[model samples]
Target: MYILKKNEKFNIDNETITFREIRDKLTEEFTELVKAIVNYSYDKTLKNLKAVVREAFDVIQVCILILRKCHTISKDLDYPD
Candidate 1:
């Protein structure tokens, strides 16, 4: 997880990705959807929005997979008393 300062700067190390990157990527996708909806015809815009949503869902699924893998690794490293 990356922490943001008051000025909205993130402190992420080079080797690791912070949650902020995921959030920003999602936000950019949503903005693209909104732009497509506003600038294109109804049918075309709807298709574009659907595509954007599918892509966003894929990103979320990837994040979930990564988190699950991390959880499994963490559990393996724990000691039972």
Candidate 2:
């Protein structure tokens, strides 16, 4: 993500994915979404706010998907937390 530094790392304890891996995915997708917004802004002479909005939505959607998956696993394990 843009929030992450280029050399910073985090351990996510996932069975298959590291934190860097997930962050990379989020960054790539968000970059694509931002590029789309920027393209539209440039082509239409719109504002930079479009890029901010699209990036926010992309992050939120990615978070929701990850949270939901974890929540489901938690429920299956009967863990409230």
Candidate 3:
């Protein structure tokens, strides 16, 4: 990918490559690699998930307070554990 560019000539192996080719070849390569990494196993309890929800809601409440719209709205959001 670093060696190829559109309308650019490479003087190696008596062939030329373009960025479009590099992009096409590497696009799905990166996507597949990311998908492999994204398929991860998370062994966490419902309590842990509830804690995450509560923490995220706490920050959201702070943002709502700053926006001066619905600070209490976040308080009403309950985490079912």
Candidate 4:
């Protein structure tokens, strides 16, 4: 799916993609990919999966930190309370 700008046109096999449509499609695709990865890791030996889980946890931690910082900054700018 492609995002169209003003006066932009494109042909697709199905239908023209909108911003929301693209967003939803991407969300579903990412969700499916994560699910597949997790399932594969689960079916593997613990020794092999440990590193992958640890890396995933680290990524989660970093994402949480970044999100917290973003929230703090957004709140500070929007409402200094």
User: How high is the CA lDDT of each candidate model?
Assistant: 0.51, 0.59, 0.39, 0.46
Residues 1-81 of candidate 4: C-alpha lDDT, one tens digit per residue: 122232122121122334454445445545645765686667876654665565555444334434444555567585645
The candidates, ranked best first by lDDT, are: 2, 1, 4, 3
Candidate 1: tens digits of C-alpha lDDT, residues 1-81: 322222122232323555566566547656655666555545566767777666556455445534644654577675522
Q: After superposition, which runs of candidate 4 have C-alpha atoms over 4 Å from their true positions?
A: 1-44, 79-81
Cα lDDT for residue 71, candidate 4? 53
Q: Report residue 14 deviation for candidate 4 (angstroms).
A: 47
Clash totals, every prediction:
0, 0, 0, 0
Q: Give me the runs in candidate 1 sitting further than 4 Å from their true place.
A: 1-44, 79-81
Kindly list the per-residue Cα lDDT of model 3 for residues 1-81, writing each as its tens digit.
122223223122212333454344445445544444344225356655665555444444333323332333345568422
Worst 10 residues of 2 by lDDT: 2-11
TM per prediction: 0.44, 0.46, 0.32, 0.40
> Who wins the TM-score comparison?
2
| Higher-scoring candidate on TM-score, 2 or 4 | 2
Cα misplacement distance, residue 38 of candidate 4 (Å): 13
Tally clashing residue pairs in candidate 2. Answer: 0
What lDDT is obtained when candidate 2 is compared to the true structure?
0.59
Pairs with steric clashes in candidate 3 = none
**Model 2 Cα shift for residue 23 (angstroms):** 5.0
RMSD of each: 8.7, 9.3, 21.3, 11.2
Sorting all predicted structures by TM-score, with the top scorer first, yields 2, 1, 4, 3
Per-residue accuracy of model 2 over 1-81 as CA lDDT, tens digit each: 332223223333334554456677678768877787777767764455666676677667556545654665687685658
